[model samples]
Target: MDIVFEELDYCETHMGDLMLRKRSIPSLDGKIIYEVKLGEEFLMSSLFHDAEVALSHLGLDSFGTKQVDVVVGGLGLGYTAQAALEFPNLRSLTVIEGLSEVIGWHKRGLVPLGEKLTQDSRCRLLHGDFFELAQSANLDPEHAGRKFHAILLDIDHTPEHFLHLSHGGFYQPEGLEKMARHLHPGGVFALWSDDKPDEGFCKVLESVFASVEAHLVEFDNPILGGTSSNSVYVAYAQ
Candidate 1:
């Protein structure tokens, strides 16, 4: 297969080091999308569409009926953010991206598809660590008594197949506890994973929230009928 490379950039996430590259392949539905890698490991390919669906599965209602505020942890090609914007009841949408360049790519039109979401009136893009924002959102005095209707995290590959070591904390007991604090009572906490996290994540969710559920999302292609499984875990605060 002949692959055409467009641009390459470096990024360091909590997990470790990653190289973001743009590539073009005729077989890839003739569309060019960014691909992410950690050292030699193939973290994620742009061809997959499950990320957007996982992000959108949070199921938030329009603000007219009930105001909803959302905090999305990773921007990632803007699919998730784009889906979140579909909600009419959304009061505010804050997207926290750890990489400044990723955000820049969206602004400069390199990733033209994501630009509108970043520029939307309801959206605010923050260039910083997602965990820090998670912590601040939970404890900030100014935001006291305020909580997000939905907290959607699509960082790392998945809890079970993490690209970075530090990402493990997000699936741990302490991490889930802190994450739960940021969610409004009855609000949803949705996590996207490349694969199921060996039941440990569910146990952690159970320990922190009143209910936990998992949904399996499978991808099928036209030619080979390619299939990959991704899981969405939803935890609700009592």
Candidate 2:
């Protein structure tokens, strides 16, 4: 039997109430959609992930090296990490997620891309805070002071909006420089934002990176009966 609506999992964390749900909309031909919510805000949905996938392509495609080691901040729905693994030349992918419940969804096969990521020898799911890790030099605990070829971030809503107050520092010039230290020279840093391209954030990127570009990715909005767009900021470290 098809579940019209089901809340798969719900738990309380330091962050807030986190819930994972699966539902089918009869109006949309019973298309099953998986949704994750933290507190009152909807974190991610399986229905709209075009920008999430683009975060990987835009970042990895801009890298100068063929063998790329990548770090993905935020494991929401595993879309960004899964997309990064699709790269043929990707050497390794480390995903840093703040919440353990989110990781549990993947390890327990509650999410669609769970097994695909876990079975892949190249991917590693690490439980930690991305913002805190960004401040530190090493993203991987196994390797101290290791630099990556690319860092793809999808944690906060935008450079100005954040899930936590502490995350706000990562967008600043000093914090950005700290995160840049963990990337190889000419490495890529791409971010996914729900808002349209922001010129202010671009200026911040230009201050730290050799080049910067904001890509507007548009996708169909089935529920809204129109189109919606998201912003992707891709920058290369000098």
Candidate 3:
């Protein structure tokens, strides 16, 4: 089967070059979303349903029956946002994407998978620096004290192997501390990583959160299968 590329968007990041391609075929129900090759490999796509499930699980567990506010760091294919919206208790979902072009792709409906999510009244897509947003959330009195019930981050493959070196701080002790501060006491923080990080990263998480655990997510499809597993790190603020 051949994949037809319908649209292409390019972005030059401090780390390297990145592109998003919208591909489709008659047999598929909707357009397939692909993040163009980064370094030498393609990161992820709409085809991976398990990764999205991992994100949804976190929100469902945290929200319970109360209206929960969520802050999702990356808006990849709107999977996390879509999952957040599924929960009736979700009061608001703020999806912050670092790249402006990525936001455009969603707004233009290039990635049909995320079209409904982008249009949801509860979903707010912000085009800005995620790290900055995270930091600002910690400083603003109105936001700082308001702990988001759940924070889902899918920004990088791993905390250590940041897509951009400047983002390295996010994985460090200070960064985790800042993140913990933003969470309402007992709130949960969930992160998605393409690969597992070193023990040091786990230790950093443990230092801030009362408890920390990693869950491995596996997919069944052959094209989406292999040893390529996504790890979800969950931590609860003390």
Candidate 4:
């Protein structure tokens, strides 16, 4: 028999009830999976990371072997950021996280890939709300009015479901247009969605971008004992 253990941590944020936990699930082979949570919801588990990694590959694939600057909006488990760094042609990667505790986890080496992503020379961890920063004239505090080759986001559940009510605005045409201003010409904007692609959302992107695509990323779900899927929305700047 395998024993399950959980050590919970708490934090306070304007968004809502914030909590993070280290869940250890053991199996017959002594394999274990670590998970992070927010409130009552399961945020990210080490076992299911294919979709997170796919967010990087599918988003950056079109760039080919060219050196490019990138920004990852969320840094859950560091899977997406780590995947972006795997591209040798990637020049720089800046990860903007809403919660300071999440960034501290990587600095403190609490998560598996956190330490490695933090140690990478090409990766820069910044403390800020990604949605707010994306709309700002200066995306990065160090570099004013800077633009990136690619901007990948994995913050909300989907266009219809948002973590905070304020986040809802970012999905609108005006908000998306502001984000586009932070992208270099022909740059890509990618977002990870927990739900299937929404046609309405695609139309909104189409209005603001030169091109748009939604990729269905499938992965094995150990919890459900079946396959699961997520959507990665990629758009190009004009």
Q: By descending TM-score, how would the candidates be arranged?
A: 2, 4, 3, 1
Better of 1 and 4 by TM-score: 4
How close to the true structure is residue 9 of candidate 1, measured as C-alpha lDDT? Answer: 67
Candidate 4 residue lDDT tens string, 26-117: 53254566677676777777888888898899889989988899999998779999999998799999999998888988888777787799
Model 2 Cα lDDT, one tens digit per residue, 40-74: 99999999999999999998985545898999999
Error of 4 at 175 (Å): 0.5
Over 4 Å off, model 1: 1-3, 8-18, 59-64, 136-146, 222-224
Best by TM-score: 2
Clash pairs of candidate 1? 15-164, 62-89, 63-89
Worst window of 10 by summed lDDT in candidate 1: 133-142
Which of the numbered candidates is closest to the native, going by highest lDDT?
A: 2
lDDT of each: 0.72, 0.92, 0.74, 0.86
Stretches off by above 4 angstroms in model 4 are 26-30
Model 3 misplaced regions, further than 4 Å? 1-3, 11-15, 24-33, 38-41, 137-146, 224-227
- Checking candidate 3 for backbone clashes, the offending pairs are 147-184
lDDT of prediction 1: 0.72
Residue 63's lDDT in candidate 2: 51
TM-score of each: 0.83, 0.97, 0.85, 0.94
Alpha-carbon lDDT of model 3: 0.74
